[model samples]
Target: MVEMTGIVDVAARAGVSVATVSRALRGLPGVSDATREQIRQIAAELGYVASPSAAALPTGRTGAVAVVSPVATTGWYFNAVCEGAQEVLAANGFDVLRYDLSEVETNRRRVFDTQLLRKRVDALLLTSLPLTPEEVEALHAMNRPVMVVGPIVSGLPSVRIDDVEVGRMATEHLVGLGHREIAFAGGDPDDQLGFPVSPDRRIGYAEVLREVGVEPDPALTVPAKFTVEAGVAAFAELWARDVRPTALFAASDEVAMGAMHEARRHGVRIPEDLSVVGVDDHDMSWLFGLTTVAQDVRAEGRIAAGTLLEALRSGIAGETTVTTVPTELIVRSSTRPAGQSAS
Candidate 1:
């Protein structure tokens, strides 16, 4: 009996997974152009024949949009955006399938390394994710419309606020009010998830600080994930510093509220001992009288979804359009001029 050369041999020779070999041979979108060509050549050389099951591509519309997040998708912003998007997509007779990696490597690989990203949705909506060059190529090859929220990518349609402007606006408000030593607590400064929101805002804040001759202090920035508890921890980190900031610019209202909560515990008074500001005029921002740079989060989601729907209707499958939303600074009692008592 002669051993037969199979798809496995082709995949091994091509240094790709069996699934990738199948996708490349079947003319699916997940495989990049270069990789697909390489796989084809290798398969032909090996005389590999794909079974009918392996070659068949699914037909018709999925009636769904994929909402992918590089990290966890349980934050207030994520929820609000999805709610707005769902309201629009549901009304339009489509479903939203979410794939949140929760910052886990396995989940991330599973979503990106397989057909999960390419086959299951008519369109894709990414939340603050920046992809690799290969990933971008794969997306382009798939030929589906892709939209992003909270980050900008070349050739990709996105709906997000001008994050740099949001940061500059927040920082300028604090600076204008005579608060010099402003601390920031928001997304990770390292930005391991590779989203533009944090970095762009960081740039804005730094620019504002530089214009006023105040250097941005690395000690004052904290990676407070967008949550109240994370905010509390981040504020504690800031309070522990030898030269604490008199004013804090939290990236979100939840962080501001949590920081405020922690401030009270340490006998530091809001606006009196330490002025604070945040982005995202969350519902609770009003309850806490928290001043924030407010972006219409739900409306952003709606706009993102609506754009994807338009692409579906028009058979447009590229990430070329960008819809920018407006952001407003809402003043409340949480921030005030740094008083003499503040140190």
Candidate 2:
């Protein structure tokens, strides 16, 4: 039998006190982020297994769930999902520990490599984060229940919508309105977190165009940061082109709102001059009269949280299941037939 690494060994390797190591490993507030990370790295290298008694409560569990999100909780989708998840978790007597990584490589690495392994959370809820194979394996090695809220990662249970189908619905709506010269405004395909939705949506858009015998125009596709400001700038670039599109398909409602604002600034009429469609029926979609493909993001979060809770109660780990949320196209007054005059 091999020897197990002890806390003192980890403390010695990391050049920190045993108490400091304890604080760091438990994710307490006393230790600095850098020091905590170093201690965790050393513990992993030393193959330290935290004593179950070190993290156990009177109830025999931490009673906390870690919710990992790649971005801040400002966006509508993120905020709604978090709200829904929090509601369910809180009702079930579990506290949520939110870890917003800002889609930074170092932050993501630290969370996956060290913080998660600290055994502070009973389960993990990953929201819209694309994990590498190694990261997934690390989570598996933890032997704790894990749930995903967006984009399926192989061998993990997830709750999400068919992003490709979402893109197709948006594009099909534009095509049905007699739009031939159409543009796409969406998130960068190469974002730091490796999010697959942006690229998947782009693929769906291109596929629809090809099916209709229309060659997808590379020049009309613009990558942005999935924010209203980014959408405005992207639309400006498209407007600068000599051959402007008659309609645009924004990847999200915020982007569509930005495009509409930009068009208004340029004295361009909506529907008459340029029709705009987007995904996600944002709160302001009705105010802007924007057409969009809508999904219940908050409901997805609730379901994801519930799923994790179920797995935890059953004491089963690594049982893969997939739950797909549905989406629908909501047609407002934003889109009209191509070449139609303003009423």
Candidate 3:
């Protein structure tokens, strides 16, 4: 029978005392981050597993991080962020627990009001989940290290892209192509989920249109969820109008692709009869030849997780840290000059 490698073996391999190994493995104070990482690596190499009950006795930390999101992990953006954060947390001997509160209202309330107070996780990562002032206060009252991804929450560190700028860039691209009548396909500003992204993008789009001397038309703006089916319905509504827009700016690539598919189904050639642009260079954007403003969702998640880990290591809750991810517009065959021939 093979014997299990013990902490003494990990300490010997890591060139550290067994006491120090115990401290590092337990995630207790008094150990440098570098030394802790080295000891962890050595322990992993030697097939050493610390007893959970023993480890928790000294540190009172579960060594698990909780990620809270408003939506399920099925979407590309949500999945990418979770994957990136999980990679970093797993590397540091920490497990990730995801709380997806998208499906049921009772589940969302239970998580925020009662479940979080049980102190199950060492830290919290909130992604695009809108919080009421009361909920934010409740989260702060927990006294756990908290980091946010997406919208800015007061008294919390956050990593997100400038959504308004993303909207402006998408609109400007179509405007630069001499498109005068442009339509926007996005979600409602005051959605039930409380995501402010759609509203921020709408502001950017309107600002750009006014700057270019084009009067923004309320009739041309269509509200829809950030999905392909919603985009199809939104585009259909816009198409049925007496004055169809020559260009379309979708809030997400999935929406843009859907609009394109619907347009083609109605015999409207892309970039010929109409031009299209979108935000979020989604996984299938290339397959559909979508032009979009691209933001790194995975990087945002990784950075948010890294920030929380740093706070846990340093034990400093100094000032709230805010990191902004940048976006870029990628032009493709999906867009062209207004009234130009589609090559």
Candidate 4:
């Protein structure tokens, strides 16, 4: 038997008309729910892979999008975002291709310049990866729409929290409880990209310090990678210092947990001896009774997907807009007034 290669084949297998098949495949209006499902199932069973050139020849779309992250498998943030984007994209008849670049320049160039990126995807969803000036320009030049989660690129529609504000918010929460000497626990500010996050968050911490008439002390600032071990190491290093902070504003929940562990080892008490606050409300934050600023990663992901869909349907590309998600302080048993020491 011979195989058919166009809308006719899909329609034949789905028991629908060519027009109905087109509508279902393109996610256009005027198709019944049952018809859409039938068409999709038929397409899948037939092993029918749409050629980008062929698909675009008629509809000018590849029916797919690229989701590029420093790492899509990032603890919670990236995973939630990818889930949200996939939910929306798949529902709209667009498939997702995930790529984890992890900040390797060589891998990045290969992903961008090779067949992996060659017109296979109609758009891109960038999650928390800092694209160099040239990279941003290159995506712009490709003329594909790009939606980002966390921080903004020069000309990309992005969904992000005001990370500086997030940092400040966490700090102010602690300061309101009368924490005078506070320290930051995270990666080195001078490191590459520092992702802009480390520094922006630190600024918020500094702002609160200055607001409370406390001069910024470099000695109080601690640096570590965004990992549990890094957090542990940073806290241990700070513990060795003659002047330990009465409070800590950890960059992430993982860091916060590390600090809590080290504090316990040194016979320091939580909320009693030290007040702690962190960002990301990570999975273990609650388990450890950690206070944190919670941003809905899942909701951010869903909204990003919606924004990208709007752009795709409206034929808009390269419109860089910032969407800020709010953060909430979840007060718990981990913080208290400075004078309370359990050591």
lDDT of each: 0.82, 0.84, 0.84, 0.80
| After superposition, candidate 3 runs with Cα above 4 Å error | 1-47, 114-118, 189-194, 341-343
True lDDT of residue 91, candidate 4? 88
| Clash list (residue pairs), candidate 4 | 186-224
Candidate 1: clashing pairs of residues: 155-319, 156-319, 157-319
lDDT of 2 by residue, 1-343 (tens): 5787889899888888998998898788999999999998988888887765555754357888888887683477777788889999999978888888885877788778745544678888988887888888888877788889888888789998888999899899989988888998887756655777777788888889998999999899988766788779878888887558999999888888888998889878898899999887988799999999998888998998998898888887746888989999999999998889557
At residue 198, candidate 4 shows an lDDT of: 67
* Candidate 4 Cα misplacement greater than 4 A, ranges: 1-60
Residue-level lDDT tens digits of model 3 in 124-234: 888877777788888787777888898777777899889899889999999999998999999754576467887888889999999999889999999877788888888
Native-referenced Cα lDDT, model 3: 0.84
For each candidate, give its TM-score against the true structure.
Answer: 0.77, 0.79, 0.85, 0.84
Estimate, for each residue in 1-343, the C-alpha lDDT of model 1 and write its tens digit: 5867778898899999988998899787988999999999998888887543333344546778888776564477777777788889999978788888786768767766537666677787877776776767677776777787877887778898998999999999999999888998888655544766766787899999999998998997888867788789988887787657889988778888899999889888888888888888986789998999999988988999999899888886645877889999999988888755634
lDDT (0-100) at residue 266 of candidate 3?
A: 85
RMSD of each: 13.1, 12.1, 4.4, 4.2
Better of 2 and 4 by TM-score: 4
Tell me how candidate 4 scores on lDDT.
0.80
Clashing pairs in 2: none
Better of 1 and 3 by TM-score: 3
What's the true lDDT of residue 292 in model 4? 94
